[model samples]
Target: MSSPTHSANTGRIILHIGTGSFHRAHQAWYLHRLRESGNEHALDWSIAAGNIRSDMNPTHEALAAQNGMYTLETVTPDGVRAYEHIRSIQHVLPWSPDHAPLIECGASRTCRIISFTVTESGYYLDSRDRLDVSHPDIAADLDGARTTIYGVLAAILDARRRADGGPVTLQCCDNLRHNGEKFRAGFAEFLERRNLAELKRWVDEHTTTPSAMVDRITPRPTPDIRPHVLAATGFDDRCPVMGESFAQWVIEDDFIAGRPAWESAGAELVDSVLPYEEAKIRILNATHSCIAWAGTLAGFEYIHEGTGDAEIARFAGDYITQDVIPSLLPSPVDLPRYRDVVLERFGNPDIRDTNERVAADGFTKLSGFIVPTLRDCFARGASPSATALLPALFLAFLARWADGTLRIPYRDSLLDHQEIRAMLASEDPVAVFCADRRVWGELASDSRLVEAVRTASHSVNLWLAARHGVHNRK
Candidate 1:
């Protein structure tokens, strides 16, 4: 580990577990901006990033070839594109079978904080907020050595506890609402599963998990991004990332040891991250999903194209104005302005965010993003008319999957192919689909959701067919 006096390597360290493009464009970008602003303390906060999945080996090769430096390409709605070099990550170990390097980094005295971005499903959490030990990875990680979040975290914290590394914070940059609290519970429950009583005590006394809301529409980095960066910057950057011009991060100001003054780089350091998170989740995220699914049904390729379409645009607008905004009435957010900004960001043509990319994990998005609005509608005794359009759109999208009419592939980790087949074969497929608790929660049995979805699904099918018929005539 580098000491505080080490000029080249800096002082305080942040161990990030995933080297995904979103992290490159979002969290690490913030720290890089802090350093660029000539903040002396920012020099101490170099990131050491690695990966747990083999899928990230290509990303590892690309980034390591560049010494963790990458170009960020930003585009706005008016077709303006900009590029910048980002360099907050100073060291990376990549993915390896040996855990020595990661554990060593996590246990070091200078490593004040650790963060990760494995997306929502990567947490391996069930609806009840328990670790699904039955999962193959969790099962393998239980009594053996493996690299799931819990396994790696346990190994690292065990070393930290033994070394008396003082206090540290765990930051989950994933999009789960109440992410910090949820991940804290997950780690504790995972510790209980492992029976690491002593280490659990150490974590309870020393570690803090702070929630954050991060927004940046980072598309999956493909080979094209590399050449785009090269052409724009006169550098052959291998792992360049691209996003919309808009970015926002709001974090809870609860750190155990200490943290970088991230606000120096435009991040919001607030007493609570709830208002920001709720606004982003219900408005931005839910609307993002609505556009992805509805736009796919309308045969659009990219999210911007979908958000640009008149019908799809109205679908997203109605969702926010009619149902979601009402559910979140009298909140701290300036709803109207934020809504327009979200639309502008989404419709940025220069950013080619694929509907297939945004539309992945529909099952998870239904529960995590859209279902809360539905629940709120029922709670307030309001008709979920607009909210019901979301699920109706999703089910109609799934029909494209079942009928082999999908123009692009879609995948959801939690989706069951057999069950989908069964639903397609049922007398009332909409009713069968509505009954799945994973998608609808306890209200899966509610009759209003069933009828609303059924009517909406029929209307969606007709709309899609009409669009296709007109196209065929043309």
Candidate 2:
């Protein structure tokens, strides 16, 4: 198949640099819809997709063969429907040794925004929430006299600086709380380490990193489903994307280089995104972790299947409402409504959000999404009985993976393997669970919570052993 040529579009070009399925189904689809509403001229937006990983070549070829357009299968409660000709993207750039084109695209006068959905690990932050310069790729970039933190951004900024252009908005659509602030801190740290204080100052003064809340359930496409996707889309897309019908993007209005009246494109541009971020992170993401770990151990595959079980669903809902929501810092949220919405989203049979997929990256994910709720529960003098089980379940999941009962492809392969091995090799699972300062941070030393987690870990271990007849087999 021949690669598609870039079409001329009058909108401000938007570059989305990620190979993940979620980016294609969620962000790219949103831009496609915005363009379809006769706003393409006004928005002047087109997406040039790129991936940093070498394994993404197949996806790049498929997307390019389809002319930078494909189908989005949205499975909603009502029904499943295919959206064709979702034409927001203009081209795909496979991983390359030279990133000059990507740098040039981002620095172009016409390119107003750059969005990323690279998973949590993509940020390459250390435990201290600073850039991890020791990362192999980061070291290579630095060795080549390029700035770390994805040298493309720095290169673009340099190009823009040369052109005397204003800074572009760097929008992050990741799952991190205060994601914008985290990116700013990481970028600043990266600059400081390289003695680029002047460029750092320019970024601080000219750029805007807006906090955003993005929600969607996009699963990796399996071989069995590839044919269905091709049939529905009429394209041989190797990495066609699938997602739930529900989607949302809430952003704080803080763009410096100006942006598409994304509000005009159906995005909610609010004066403050803190409330939305808090609600989604604490309620949505926290509950997701609970469901993932607990449901996986309970022998459930997809979220809808697990949530379909009354007991498991109720446990998750109650944990969020009774323990997690009340512990949040801001004023109380509508726990009942949020729980209902979560259950509904979870029950969307079309979503097919797998437990194993969600359960991946337990180490980093637990600290960011689950630990805060656990800590908050402790602060409010509340029992984290149900909330505490989440970490225990995660530990068990890691243990299972370590014992070769399950397998997952992790982004930080070395760190994940080492952590899992260490946990598995520990004399007492409880001690290892409680003493891991990196995993639990300061909460590791809290006697009360430590005991609670230790007890929970023991129970989970025993339960798994008994349920799976490990003892009898031994």
Candidate 3:
């Protein structure tokens, strides 16, 4: 690990275990803003961030070379752009296969909050919220491998307990619905499965996982950003991050170990993050995926392209106004205005958020983002046609991928490659997909769900045909 440029202080540390673009653009940005404000509470907090995996080795190297400093380029929907030098991360731990440095930092009493941003599928949870013990990663983690979150956290917490390190909060900065709760459950189960009853008890008594809702349309950092940052900011930052100007973080105020005054930096420390998370997951995230899948089918590369199309926008708008808002009635959030704002953000051309980025992990999104609205609509005796279109679009997108016709390589962490191929070869592909319990949970057996998905799939095919000026399918 490289020493930070800024002098070390007596401030407590936030050991964040992901140095990806989203983490830099969102969480690290918030801390940067907080520190820049010169608030006394904020000054007492700092971030020591690193990745659990070596996939981000280049980014880590760049950050370490620059003393954990980077430039953040933020653009608005109207093409307005701004750059800021972010210096919130004071430590950039080098990547290691054994995760020794990360575990050491996380085990320290100075590390009051151990936050992480593994993607949604990284949790390894099944439809019923149980840890997917059958997954090879989860299985390996159970037997002392430190690859997955469960594996890493288990090692960290056990070390912390052994060191007599004080209590710490385990904050999950992911898109999973009820993310903190789900993570805590999985972590507890992981310990129990390992038969580490002492460590499990200590964690249960000491740690607090507050659910949070984080939103920012941060694309994977493109090469164009580096030159722009250099020209604008006079800094040749190698690891510049970019995102839309719109960002929101609503966290449940349940931190056990003291936390920073993030509210001063535009973060909402709410009593309950339920409404905020539901709105984000269902309205924004699900709609984002809808546009991505639809845009990809229409041969569009960017999310802005899909959101710009009238028919595609209508599909997304109707999903929000008709199904999502209805299900989330009595929410404190302004459903209509929020829906409009979300769509506008999606239409931001400068962000350059790709269809492939938003469309990855369709299996997880099917259950996490789309199915809740479907189930709610069914319970209320209302049609979920708009919501159903998301899965339908995904169905079309998946077909393209299976047939080797997709323009971009589809990456799904939870995708079963061989199973998908077999399903495509089967006589009734749509039926087989609709029946997948992993995506639909118990709703897979519901005839209404089957019909809605089937109808929506037909509509999607027709829409694709019209876009290409071809005849409709039988």
Candidate 4:
């Protein structure tokens, strides 16, 4: 075990929160490559990883056992694969019931940047992009307890402000739309709810939360991967992460306390990450959901399995090429080329990205990814045919849920048992689903959007029925 060491020699630390597969594969791998970049200062930037939730304890313990050294299996579409040892994570802080250690690290002087890869739902934001202070965890944190990221961050920021721990950058590497800005906003609201005026001022002045766009297809680790890594690397790496060979990180380059030379190691440190963020969310994230929901309804297990099916592939490509691309047209990014690359990534047979994983957080995915392009298209007076299919597919997916057909867990941070009951009882399930502020935002009230979703849901129902060799009476 590397233990906890602090020094310029050990590398200036980035205390990364949420030690998930994506972090190990993307952010840590980038830092690992930076360490290999032969730059003197790059050696000083390392990750001390932890998680906000206790369910991640297994992965955390595995990393702690391996001294945060694990094999990263990179597979390409053409079936090329390589296994490399990722050693950038120098310290793995095991999960604690109370995050005292986490707060301490945030209060420490050695670490100047705190990066996170908690999924989109981890943000706990309402439809208005404000912190859902009513969320039990957020409320608990507001009541001087800790649980959610906001709670943990509040504690860390409080400690930092009190100790003069200096400024730290909160780099959000999730698939969030305008992640940095949204995080800053929600965090500010969280602080306000906690009534920490002095600390809030300190935060506004000292810290910088930079938006970032990160891309990689690191699926959930499987048991077979553990044995495969042992065979490939001759080491028992319990937390070995496997992903596609493709990876990219685009940061807004707005750090308060300096950052690593990530650009030197295949990251793009840009002045603004909006264009990249828009392209990624619309073309990649949205279409990913499109394929997943469609795939799930069609009874495909993995993403590649569905993408390999010509019908599902055409569905995804049509949505992107018809609706997403046109909405992103006349832009800085070559939309067509970006779409092609994303499709290629999704088609990686070795990745085995499960459709259920992609389709789980449909409520958040719609607003963050699918809805933006939809709103853009509608504002520009464009038809919502291609984009409408996503909500339709989600509705059908929900219908499967109502009928007890969905085998995998569909997690929504805000969804309650009562809401599920309401969904099942609702006569107009599609309208009711679309009307939820969480999924459609203000678009819920848009008559055109609601009607489009209804029509699209019917169309998707027919398509799904045909795929299953069933003829609908209607």
Candidate 5:
């Protein structure tokens, strides 16, 4: 283990919550690269990362033990592997149930940016982008619990206000649509619910939350990664991370306090991240879920396995070609080339991205990733048959999950287990699922969506029946 030492640079910090593989591989890697760029402003900033929950305590311990340094392993689609020792995270705060250390760090005047990656469903928003105040976690947070992001952030901001800490930016690095704006709205509403009118006003005047689009395919470390790291890098890195060689970050350039020169590290500082975010959500993210659910149903263990399957690849490719690309016409990005590149990246066998990991938050993915394209297509008087296959595959996957036959755990942070079970037990599960206001919103009553899902579900069933030997087998 590297000997722990204080950072020579001081006065500016980005306190990133959720020290998961993606955060380490994407944001932290960018900072590491920026520092290596020898830019004068690079050394003036560093990361202080921690998690809100105890589940990542092991990661925290390992990272702290290594003095916030770890090896990042990345592989290209052509099987080229590379390793870099990442030292961007200068401090790894110990986890506590109450988030005391996190709040303290976030409340510090020197901490100019507070960023997080809690995944799509962790935002606890409905299809209309409204915070679900009725959610158990949100409700608990409103009652002074610190289990959720809103709760923890509220505490942090409140302490910061009391300390008269100068302005800080709240940067959201999740895959959710308009992540920073949505987080601001949710946080505002959460404060309203908690009766913190003064704090809300203070936040309105003192902070700027910028939407960002972050992309990286960082998979959970498998059993063999540690041994490979030991042999290759001479470090027994307990908190090592692995990801695809491709990565991207597009952020709205609206920081209140001074910020890092991240553009030096290949990050795009944009006036608006909308076009890029929309393209990524509809094309790459939606198709990723489609392949994962389809692959899971086909008994494939990794994403590359499903992408390698001709039929599965056809379904995903057709979704992008037939619906998503047309819906996102005249985009700044070359949608067709982006789709091809995304597929090519997903087909990288060495990445070992798992179906279970990709397929976890299907409920959130349906609304956030797939529904926009369907809505746009319908608005333009076009059929979204190919796009419809994504939800159909998810519905089929949910059926396996409801029937206790799913090979892997189906974890949906936004899923209401009892409600889903009731829906699945209903007379027509597809119709019931299609009619869910939370998932379909105002489109729930639209017959076009219902009929499309019904038809696609049938096709999915037929496909699964033909692949019976591999269906849900380990």
Candidate 6:
């Protein structure tokens, strides 16, 4: 088969600025499938890659060498299906301090849509969901007259405004609830603070940040899978992606300039994505967090191994179906069906998602993904069960780092293990860990929840004592 090319004949451009694996496997692959399914008009959508991080140099090289194409392997229980011509990307912007090209793309008349999977922390928002102007990088971006927010996005929006562009659809593919709204709010907050009232007004009039719910178990590439991906595609792409067969993108149709009939591209465009967002975040994401920390502490490496352990699996399932779901108001979701899907996805052996990877960043993951669900349960006066244990396990995980029992595998990142170690060594580790007003926010003082977490930590300590004879150092 010939390599796929963007159907430029239709005169539409789809700019994906992030080069992360999730972007490739989920959004880019979806666009590829849309083109293959005879959506020729949609095929005109082209993706120009952009990245700000210094580490993306090798990724840019590998992707450019392959003509901006790579293989997407979807592993299922039935078998593995691989697509060779997964070509939604048209060009990649070289990682440079000057982001003029990115800005121009966003402002282009032909570019009606912009999409992103820049993870949870990318927005640069403080705990209160406001833009964190205090962040050194954010301050630098602002001071330098950088066009992009967070370096890349602000430039794109700036270019769009200069081009006399109409409202451009801003689709956020992150895991946060009302994610699009959050992005817009953050941008607006920055504008207001910087006294760019005029630009803020322009944005308010022109852009639409549509809330979206996206899910897929895209695991970070491992050493073992890298060779397989290379052999399969005959290219040595260092950042190959691996994911489960399942994928979903539920978005609200609140675009400004226009949008790809993303619906035509297998994305569900809804009137309101709030319910879907809540359902996925509370059930899928929250349960994933539970399994991650719980499974890791139990010595299970992969999600499949974690699920195979009856006690851990039961704890996960019960926490979601029983405790988490019931706490929601006027629950329109089918919890049982959701649980089944989560189970099958977690058991996808080919994905090889590590518990340790998911278990990292428990501070952010717990507060954003899991704690809200716990809060809802408490608000509804529900009993604490396995759901209550989520935070407990997270606290224990943090506590373990103090004793050097757990080590963060990722290279130098924001999550300071030394700070975590110091916090754990304090007179009251749980209190100290929870006292980081930035992290716990107001939840730091929730007496009932705090007590439950303390109890759970005690249980973990006892379990450790019993297993490894008191001074267990595993």
In order, candidate lDDTs are 0.85, 0.72, 0.90, 0.83, 0.90, 0.72
Note the residue pairs that clash in candidate 2: 10-44, 11-44, 11-45, 12-44
Per-candidate TM-scores read: 0.92, 0.84, 0.90, 0.87, 0.88, 0.85
lDDT of 2: 0.72
Give the top-scoring candidate (TM-score). Answer: 1
lDDT of 6: 0.72
The CA-based lDDT of model 5 is what? Answer: 0.90
* lDDT of residue 150 for candidate 1: 84
lDDT of 2 by residue, 1-474 (tens): 124344433446777777577887777877777777776464466787776555667777777777777766677765666655567778675556566656767767766787887787778887777788888867766555443345667776777777776678888888777788898888777667667667788888878899888888777766755687767766665556777778878888998767766676677888878777777876787677777777777677877787887656766776787777677645434666766887888888777777867776677667777788888788878888877777777777766667776544333332556766876797876677677777788888678777877777887777676757953685
> Predictions ranked by TM-score, top down?
1, 3, 5, 4, 6, 2
Q: Which stretches of candidate 4 lie over 4 Å from their true place?
A: 1-11, 53-55, 94-100, 400-474
Tens digit per residue, CA lDDT, model 5, 203-320:
9999999999999888778888788889988889998899889999999999999889999999999999999999998888889899999999888999999999999999999999
For residues 100-124, could you state the per-residue lDDT of candidate 4 as single tens digits? 7788777888888988888877888
Model 5 regions lying over 4 Å from their true place: 1-9, 96-100, 126-128, 132-140, 143-145, 360-363, 396-433, 454-474
- Per residue, candidate 1 scores C-alpha lDDT tens digits across 1-474 of 222223433488898989898999999999999988998778878888888777888877778878888899987889788998998888776577866768888898988898999988788888677888888888878886666888999999989988988889999998788999999998898888888889899999999999999889887766777788888899998778888789999999999989998999999999989888888888998898899998888878889899988988998998899888888778777988899999999988877778888888888888878888888888888888888888889888888888898888878777778777788789988889889898888879689889888888877878888889988999
lDDT of 6 by residue, 1-474 (tens): 112254332367766767887888888888777877787576667777766665666877778777678766667744575634577787666666676656666677777787777787778877678887877767876775553444466667666787786677777888777898899888777777666667778877887888988877777766755677677777665557776778888888887766666787678888988877877877787777778777777767787787776767887888877777676656556777878888777877777778877777677767777777777777778766667678777777666656667644532144676776777778987777656655666677677766777886787667655645633654
- Backbone clash tally (model 2): 4
TM-score, prediction 5? 0.88
Q: Which candidate do you rate higher for lDDT, 5 or 6? A: 5
List pairs with backbone clashes in candidate 5. Answer: none
- Across 316-360, the per-residue lDDT of candidate 3 in tens digits comes to 999999999999999989999999999999999888788988899
TM accuracy, model 6: 0.85
